[model samples]
Target: MSTLEPVEITAGSLHLRPWRPGDADAVFAVCQDPEIQRWTTIPSPYHRDDATGFVDGRSPANWATGTAAQFAVVDATSGELLASVGLQDLRDPAGHPGVAPGGDGEVGYWCAATARGRGVVTSAVEVLCRWGFGPLELARIRWIALTGNEASRRVAVKAGFAIDPAPRSLPHPRDGVIANFWTGVLLP
Candidate 1:
């Protein structure tokens, strides 16, 4: 059995925890915000149904499959859903792909509009990264941001993700052509 850990983390005003059905309403409300739709890949006309489906369907399935891990980032003090963070493409935790099997993982995150400019996401990201590198024993964590997302880039930089010298192409929602991407790696 792949030992899965139950994770709950906190930093400053941010708290990270697993998703629940009740989060559907909160996610729907946040997704409905124009800023989220504009800056992220979420559907432009995000509806309650979409959020409900994500909470009740995709999130749980990911947990069961052990392919991904996602956490809802909330305000520790207010218990407001402020963002989401996760790790993907995990190989292992110790730098070896086969023996002890440590490899690269991807870091992804997004913050609610109201949570922007408040340092909430940044603090939360730091906490999450520490957990990924420490308890998860991940060898490397990669961060990628869309070329024009300066806000996201700032968050990445703040969370120890340095910009690469050259950008690469990454998938984009509105644009058919691959968009410019910034990549950073945290190595153990």
Candidate 2:
């Protein structure tokens, strides 16, 4: 695994950094939004414990092992959690699956309810894609959304992703059912 540190990234009005323990409350609140639950893999009934586990455990562990590089998008001036974005399923050149492996990374993100419609996520995603191409040396970054997730599709398009015409099946994290999904790709 790569021992490289998760560096903070800054954009015009926002900054991205690893999640901290103090972020649990914000995480919990945002994850409770109906829109977030409907579109992403976050626990449908998100609870404090889930948020705690994510900020205190999962986020740190991912960083330490280089399995994923998750970030908390915050307001540069106020330091509020505007959203979450990550480059997941990072692999190496040999195409071995997992942390620090060589290959493409999947981009995932969710914007807080209050922060939607302002292009917060789209801007953050653009910053992350540039980081993936530069510091992370990623060849390509992929995006996927359930077929009806038009908001997410728009963000991908705004961030320069080329949406694929074909739809594929993506398994729901909480249920065994698979749903039709759309995919997009951005090459470095």
RMSD of 1: 3.1
- Best model number under lDDT: 2
Q: Please provide, for model 2 over 75-184, each residue's C-alpha lDDT reduced to its tens digit, 9 standing for 90 to 100.
A: 99999999999998787777665544236889999999989999999999999999988877788898999999999999999999999999998787678698899999
- TM-scores for every candidate against the unseen true structure: 0.86, 0.95
Model 1 spans > 4 angstroms off: 1-3, 93-101, 173-176
Candidate 2 residue pairs that clash: 91-101, 91-102, 91-103, 92-101, 92-102, 92-103, 93-102
Which lDDT tens digits does candidate 1 get at residues 57-127?
A: 87766656544567899878888898988775555554322211255667777888888888877887788
Alpha carbon lDDT of each predicted model: 0.75, 0.89
TM-score of 2: 0.95
Candidate 2 stretches with Cα past 4 Å from truth are 98-102
lDDT score, candidate 1, position 82: 89
Window of ten residues with lowest summed lDDT in model 2: 94-103
